[model samples]
Target: MYFLVMKMRSSRNILPLLSTMIQRTCKFSALPELTKDRYPNVKRGNYSQIDTKHLNFFKDLLGETRVITDENECLGYNTDWIKANRGYSRCVLKPKSTDEVAAILKFCNENLLAVCPQGGNTGLVGGSVPVFDEIVLSTSLMNRIISLDETSGVLTCEAGCILENLEKYLDEHRLIMPLDLGAKGSCQIGGNVSTNAGGLRLLRYGNLQGTVLGLEAVTANGQILDCMSTLKKDNTGFHLKHLFIGSEGSLGLVTKVSIQCPPKPKAVNLAFLGLESFDKILMVFKRCKHELGEILSSCEAIDADSLAATTDNLNLKSPLEKFPFYMVIETHGSDNGHDEEKLNRFLSSLMEDGTVEDGIATNEPSKMNAVWQLRERITEGLIHDGYVFKYDLSLPLENFYSLVGIMKERVGKDAVRVSGYGHVGDGNVHLNVAVKEFSADVLNKIEPFIYEYTSKLRGSISAEHGIGFRKTKYMHYSKSKEAIDLMKSIKKMMDPKGILNPYKVLPQ
Candidate 1:
């Protein structure tokens, strides 16, 4: 038996791609038409004034091949790693050079169209995602190492350069990027510079504020701030590039970075030590600083829970016979034997004085990575347990444990489980809470209390993660009212339209 199909035309006089009744009988029919009005439309946006002609103008400015409008190809650019924030842009623009970026920005500015600049999209915050369906300007194509000067220890690269590649490039030349992160493989240098990322090495190499000599960014007005210089000392009128660092792309789009690299150390040593109390952490740091001096490259802490989670997750042996508040200390030196001798002396003295509990030392590459994995993979295990409320905080190192104790008391046991770890030397502690669920009401009640306590202690709400959309509202507790107002005024002056990463660093 055969069925006769009847087609119906809608208000637009377009034939129904699939008849509701006919679609059921036949296995296949015509493909569903893309409902541009329903699916592709930007729900909340101020760029309605922008016309297709303007888009075409920019498309023509950049070659037609570089403009991507297909839905499949645009999916990757629309969302970031976490999948929390996302929007479907009309098109994705991939520019290969700074000139292309400038031209596109100029066209967007003239058309009054908002632009969303994207890097590796590995950001935990929603800064890289488009809240509105503005044109996504991707730096992925702009990745190119322009120069690397061994003598000056400076590496200049386009914003889209991958952090891991940069590290590899520097390694081949016996140099290193001053910053290193767990997400180094995926995060871009542009995002790093834009967020002013502080990572594990910050304790030794310092933050980007010191390592980044200069930066070049494209402002909302289509002007590029070309501050890419390797000058160690420049008494300029103002250190303008510093403003864009950690701005989360609110003021401008960073295009190129000229970062100061450090010479690679000849030797490195790793030690995993157990401690009974959090209070002993400060004492341990002091002793290490005094005894190890500049060789103390890293000082990180991990709680008992973190150790168990990491060991279980990675299927590795526990570094110690018993799990206690753990600290991983790393030392680097020009001479391997000298560094080892210093580390041995320090450990021996600590053991004799009962400052350090049980300890394990490793110079073996595999063993070193094993211990580092235990420290790095602690957060990854939280997902298996339950929902997580991750907090990257900076407080007095002494208050770390007591703060967790208070939180556990407030949130209640089993309902909330807290694990502690992070760069202890820098005072940035990763206080993660595991819960069954997190609702707006609970977050509303809990966040205020946490921020108030942190503020009372004269600590920052966010240490490494910048004030992106997630934590913008809590900025008041972290910064003074006057400081926030000045930041707003600066934002207004720099980006009059507030199109550059709107609703990101500033509270809505």
Candidate 2:
């Protein structure tokens, strides 16, 4: 099927197609419904007293096959990928089309039933999962590529479409998504927009605010805001779509997304560099950024403990025999010869200056993936080894690596296993505190201890990850009172009833 999307340049309105077309289809409910089964194992309190009259209306409107209330069927949607936070719901609504979403929201608004929209549920912040037994409006059924314009380099798809599927589809067309993450296979486009996810590619492509052209969302009052325009320059009043980009589903449920695509690089190079001290690591980043210029896509760092975790737990061999810090640098460009020559020259210069202890990578894909796996698998492997207190913070390059030393000192050299790593170019670091087990007393001390030092460094407690329930209290440390008040005002304006993903991103 083909769709000729004529996007308006002056307004938020988007023209889908003059004629209807079939793209892709999945088996799931189209609206809300009720069933005989209840979520007995859910941690939240019972929702049996809540009226399902409006939910029943949408069930009849969407059809029984679309809405699911079976105990086994609803369990999968109840929890996110982390499984750290889980909630119960009597029904799971799977709306396929915008009209169905509108109808469901209208009924929900009338009945005053709490609603939580979820995507791939791979969120680390637990924003995609419910803390209460709210009706989960699962977007899984709405996976479909509505349209793609090669000329404009714009792609539009439904909210539930997985990130990996979008990458594959774009690859087939010789295009690529502007952003990518480790959970690309399971994370959905809508979730990415909701969280404003920052991945490895953010160094080159920037954040979701830059890549996302427009969005279509169903607000709390059942209003359909379609601003899926592909215009490169739109001087519209508010740019309302930005409101939902990082609002974490508290503002509205993202039904569809229109993103700007970048051309696939002709040549890509990845190298793993071992460094002795934090000072030299920053030197390497500076030299690479200046020398490689536009070809330098990313520069990520991994400390010794992270290296040990990945090597021991994930069984990934260490690239260097001994190094306090390791860096994964990537360069992508249109010309293979030019990119390779620039990268080699940069590394050669670094070697002469003693900035990089050891550097390796010959532009081979397999080897590159292997080097990246060291950083990517570290977090995943920590889950099996011990209880991890994860923190993603943004700090100055000078102050970044010192965190490792401070954390180890405070937590004790052996009592706590701390690792610091992340996209160095972006000044975002991912530090994991691995302890044998977790207890309330230990957690209370550990959480605030880390946050206090982080606040001293002027670093964010949660850099890319949104302030979900887990980190809501710590948000005050990062955000200003006025800024936070504005966010609360916006949330109140969009969801006056406070039924959309309540008790999240803000402290009551």
Clash pairs of candidate 1?
none
lDDT of 2 at 151: 84
Which stretches in model 2 have alpha-carbon errors above 4 Å? 1-55, 413-416
List CA RMSD, all candidates: 15.3, 12.4
- lDDT tens string, model 2, 281-349? 888888777788788888898888787776666566755555788888888789887877777777777
Number of clashes in every candidate structure? 0, 2
Q: Show where candidate 1 strays beyond 4 Å.
A: 1-45, 49-55, 63-65, 70-73, 88-90, 314-317, 413-416, 436-438
Tens-place lDDT digits, model 1, residues 376-482:
66665554444556677899877765667777777766444577788988899887776645444545546778889999989988898787656778899888889
Query: What's model 1's lDDT at 356?
Result: 71
Least lDDT summed over 10 consecutive residues: which range in candidate 2?
Answer: 27-36
Task: Return the TM-score for each candidate structure.
Answer: 0.86, 0.87
